[model samples]
Target chain A: MTITLQEVLPTYFEESRRHQSEIWGKQLTFNKGEYIKIVAPSGSGKSSLTHFLYGLRNEYNGKLLYNGQDLHGYSVEDFARYRKDHVSIVFQDLRLFPEQSVRDNLELKRQLNPYHGPEKITEMAERLGIGSKLSVKSRICSYGEQQRVAIIRALLQPFDFLLLDEPFSHLDDNNSKKAMELMLEEAAARGAGILFADLERIDFFPWQRLYHL
Target chain B: MALSFQPIKPLLQTGTNAASRWFSYIGLGIGVLLLLCSIQMYINIQQLLGGDSPRKDGHDFISISKTITDETMGQLEKNLFTEADIKDLEGKPFVSGVSPLLANNFRFQLSGGSLVPFVTDFFVESLDDTFIDTVPPTFHWQEGDEVVPIIIASDFLEIYNVFAPSYGLPQISESTATNLGLQLICYYPDGNRATFRGRVVALSDRINSIIVPKTFLNWANQRFATTKELRASRLYVKTKDANSPDFLNYLTEKHYKVNKDKTKFGRVKQVLQGIFSGLGIFGLLVVILALMLFSFYLQLMIARSKDNLQLLLMLGYSPNWLSTNVARRFIPVYILVVLFAVAATQLMQWAFHHFAMYDREELTTWLHWSVFATAGFLIALSLFTNYRMVKRLLYRMA
Candidate 1:
């Protein structure tokens, strides 16, 4: 499964902004099993790009294609099937059910399209240092803990591509390294690609292909 | 309760206005109860009409005659039933058969012998044997039979018995009267007369005229002077229901008269059936209104959870799958409500049969199979409509 972007630009962005943007109005292809980095400044539509790629928004110029099929033409069932089996995403804002327990949040994802067992969730939580917070409600947990929870939730489903919109922003370097290591192991096991969009480059990880915006 | 649906359960639930749920269940219960009751009552009415009327004669036989008014007095020709009139009356849907009474146009007399010496003027008529309550096999006759068979009205016998005691005459029993023979004398206007022996063959509680066999009447009328026209002054109509408004209305519209006492039961049955039919329609309306109310409740619940639903859809829950889960959640409640209504209808039927109707042999103590089938139909309709409504609402969000 490959995603192709043909001269894509967010419709909300001005023509002047597109001229200064490297990723906009450019034909790009992100293939399966490739770790790609998209680095851009603030107010450069980083989240908009993630939302467009996740199929949450479609109001943009040019085309966003999934395996050569235009995104605009995707039916509702097609989007759900792709989300469950082809792609998964970790939103920048960590959209978790705040009142639900951390364990329940992961259980929901696992049961939707189970690619992992409950023990796998427990094993991941232990490695991320949130094993003790599994019974706690997501809202009462700290922001960094919720971010790790969100990352684990996204990884619970089977996917050929994973979209992370600055997933490690709230984490310290050590926790970020553990989370990234776990994500890479999971992605490598399935031969899935990871698209990490962030503000700047991280020293610990080197990019296979980097898009500077 | 399937684990597959648990992922969207929290987001799709809204529990504040719980009164709507109760109201819908209650309304559905009442609506279904009324519907079933209406059907049972209709069935019961049919059973009563078809059972207890005691129509030993096997059909309602009504004799109809044109009402003679002051203007029609002494105008026998105008009052007689013409061929067109008979054809029109025969064409009525309620009239199963028409048998015109053929009256003797010449003079006839009956003279009793030494046992009960009495003489009376007679006007004999003949009807088709199918309409008579009692027809002996020997009632038919040819040209030269020594004796003719006659059937007198049972009312006429009773009237004679009432007057016989005052006249110092014998009050005869049915068997004694049937064995006696009398002389039937027919006189033509040309001053020639012929006599034949007549025997009592059968008695009729239905037809009022003294009836002889059709063969005998035709032979005697040929020998005696009579008009060529075979018009009927009175006709007996066979009907399915004597008191049906359609039949009675037809009689009234044609200015024909019938005995009202015989139709009193029919009037009561008609009024009862009408009431039950009205109740059935009202019950159907209530069922529709209740379903509509439940639909509104479902809409409100889905609307309250709008934001959460959208988020769940974004989480890869298909609208169809989610709507199916939501609709399935109410299946047990719907089943319970319909079953409760059916049980209630059965109880009402049992009570009506045992207590109100005093265990009438015709009525059953349980609800009809159609009532249960209707309950099943209601459950299916509720599920399907709720499924469609939920699917439509979720599709809008999608």
Candidate 2:
């Protein structure tokens, strides 16, 4: 029953799994510093599986385990606490409040971890190349700029794992590559595992392991 | 396994989900309107009741009265005015004028046997001539016998059915105008006859009634002394001193009465009391229902906005923050609704003033304060409901 990261690799999937097919996995695991990439076609249930893992959708008939315990043991408050203190998600739509500023977006993330200082917002803004644009409203920024801010916001929060769902969707090749590099560097510094969902774009940075849904 | 009433989240993705959202807005609107109306009603009632409840004017020294027929005298004793007392108080500025005397409808069965009833109000007099001034000899006494001049009511011509210049009656000619006489065949239920020879001089249009020389009344009484019956109702009065409480007291002690027309006051009071009491009740009902509906809408909106709230909740915002934020959003709407209600009430009062000829004070006072207070109550209700809804939602979610 011991969960390991290697067994969750996409290349190790069975042939019975087809596109739009439902699959169940038990005893799933990720090492503290692992970099895992999951790829599928447009309708291959990659987002669905990601939502399941993030605790956003829980109707599926399967067991989700963490640290050798069933996921049901975690209540909504527990999930919220985990999202605030040990996990963060970068949504596919770059779901930022349009009325807020880039700095505030990141600051909101920092607030999730009560111990995080305000200086982290400035540091993250500089790293995301949005330091000058921090005061700018989110809607006013270009897609690439917004993408960077979203990633930076996700990073500002205290977390041991990052779930990125098509975080590079709107970016051009060069910006996407740069954003991927920055994301990896931030996650690696914190020794957090990064589970990224992507289409068949084939342009993502090399990952330590890949899961095909 | 213990079950929870969790939201069916999967159903929300469809467009049909928007129906509930629109419904929530409608509920909110109704609730707000109810609260506003209730507040308006309460204020109006307070204003009408003279700041608390209904009240009537207390009796005072200058108690005016009216005297009806002797047959109805017992019934009118509680409200009677004496003739001499009325005449004595004629000149007082504070003594508002007595109302014009109401007369019985008189029918003149003409010589042609046509029955015609004419409405008449004539000033009566005794033979004393105390209140009458003699016309100068140059004023041309139109007479044939004793030359007793009689100033007739203008409407006397209408009752006689004799158009002097147009009817072509011989005795009413221009040369004999000074000596024209009226032989009125006065008939009661029994057969009757009367010859009244008097010179008709001037026409009067003073008030809603007609005036006559006091002598003419005496002439009628003397001419039919054995047959004519007379009744005196009231003597129109003006007081020499309006603030003469002593005079009023003296009149009271003498078993005499003074009556001032307070119909205007009574009418104004009744109309105002009626309108404002209804408005207060309506507004109160609206607020109560509105509070309920508003609270319901707030709860529903909280449920609808659950995901957004959850995001914030996950972002380490305290439950109190969500409550404050939700309550703050409704503050402006509540304020606007209340203001609209108050403004509407004032506008309605203004309209009443513009159209109503009677009393504007009653309408104005009720609307001005009623709307304001109601609006305040609605605003507070909205805030309170919003806070409670958000708090409950947060507790449930937790």
Candidate 3:
């Protein structure tokens, strides 16, 4: 059950980056029923690469073959539709609206990319132990709480691949391990790939493959 | 320790920090002031345009005899007699009557005091019994009441200095008051003496006046008949159609001089109205200008605070999203400013009214709406300017 890149790329790519200069030499593929992790330092180009793959950066001058269809074949709008429908990102900084409550923040994301009913939010909140803190302001919450909120927000969306940028950097060892396990379990249930990057070397959870950039 | 080489984030926030704070204060101040001005202007315009309210409709038109010995009348004839002027006069709809007369302000002295009438008296062959009877001292009396004793203001009272040695200083107490019930003696050069006694029915203390009946006044004048003079120093006419063009045309064609009289009570009212309207409009203009200045300052402040906006962009939020977020935060500030302006204007108007300062009605109406409207306008303008500034700054940063 190999997940073809063409099948996943159109879900995230409004504009295909098959002919991007940066991804010209990189092999692009998504395998179903498997999780792939990309680890990189803070300043490394991992974020850039993710953007390139997601069709956010259109100036790449390389061949990115998503199941033999060049990434450049799609337009910018096509890539946005793909991102909206299939790709989700748990930002390193969490990218939460500080003015809004934690629950409202999650609600906004769910509305923007609702894969399931509101029941999914409850499930995610319970899994993250953020059920009680839903109405709290995101700014007032602990780093670990914010991290889980970010992850839950991304997990609630229906996507083939989840981009996690230092998703568990703020969590303690116990919470980090538990959050990572839950994330992997949720990804597996959805049959989605969890791609994450962090400054520290984290290795408690199991992964099918890891790449250092 | 090797410092990892990292590229700086491309987004940069621009502008000064104090811009918003400065603008906020300035904008609010201006908004409030302008709002007051607008209120005043509105009231002035209402008065000028003649609202249906009784006070607003108070005699704004003047009927002057064109034949008047006055600089004002002369100016009017010279500047306002063109065919175009006639059309303008017709359109303005002020009925004018003409009479060739010189208006004189006379200080009539009597035994008790001097009286300066607001409306000067010119002899009519037959004194309108109804009109004179309706006049005060007469109004104080009732039918079947005892023969109303009318007091006469003597030359002594008229010349009674406010700082006279005998009076020390004039006061409202009885010691300073002239004996209203007492009458000593009256005399003439003919050596005949008459005892005239009358109870003081009314005394206008402000003007130090003791008014008597026209009959007594005429009888007293017989001794001073040599000083009798006939000069039409005043031309008096009242008309329901005072603002009509035909009346003005009739006066003009008759070659009688007409001047709008400000000294007369009726004409003075019109003058006051004109002055009030002018002041109100001027005040409104000043307030509006102040509000605009404040709005400009407010935009500058908001532009400065946009540094956080760049950070949002790095999080993949677009320019439109950032603008919406900024606007949301700023809207509350403007609403607060508007509320403050309204409250402040009301307070100021109330203060003025309490002190009997400037015209209360005009001032109140101007302040109430002007402040709030100015505040609203400033907020909107500030937001618009802030939007453009943010857009331009972001484009540069991008």
TM-score of each predicted structure versus truth: 0.86, 0.42, 0.42
lDDT per residue, candidate 2, A86-188, as tens digits?
7678877777766567776666666556434678677766765778998998889988789888887787666677888888888777767777887787787
**Alpha carbon RMSD to native, model 2:** 18.6
Model 3 misplacement above 4 A: A1-47, A61-85, A90-158, A164-184, A193-213, B1-23, B41-258, B262-322, B357-398
lDDT of 2 at A168: 84
Going through the candidates in order, the fraction of native interface contacts each one reproduces equals: 0.47, 0.29, 0.00
Candidates arranged by DockQ, highest first: 1, 2, 3
Query: Would you list the C-alpha lDDT of every candidate in the order shown?
Result: 0.86, 0.53, 0.51
**How would you encode candidate 3's per-residue C-alpha lDDT over A59-168 as one tens digit per residue?**
54445554355657854334545555566777766767665678766665565446667777777787768888888988899888988988887776677777777777
lDDT of 1 at B177: 74
* TM-score attained by model 2: 0.42
Per-residue alpha-carbon lDDT of candidate 1 for residues B215-286, written as tens digits (9 for 90 to 100): 999888877856756668899988887867688778889888777677766677789988988998898888
Ten-residue stretch with the least lDDT total in model 3 chain B: B1-10
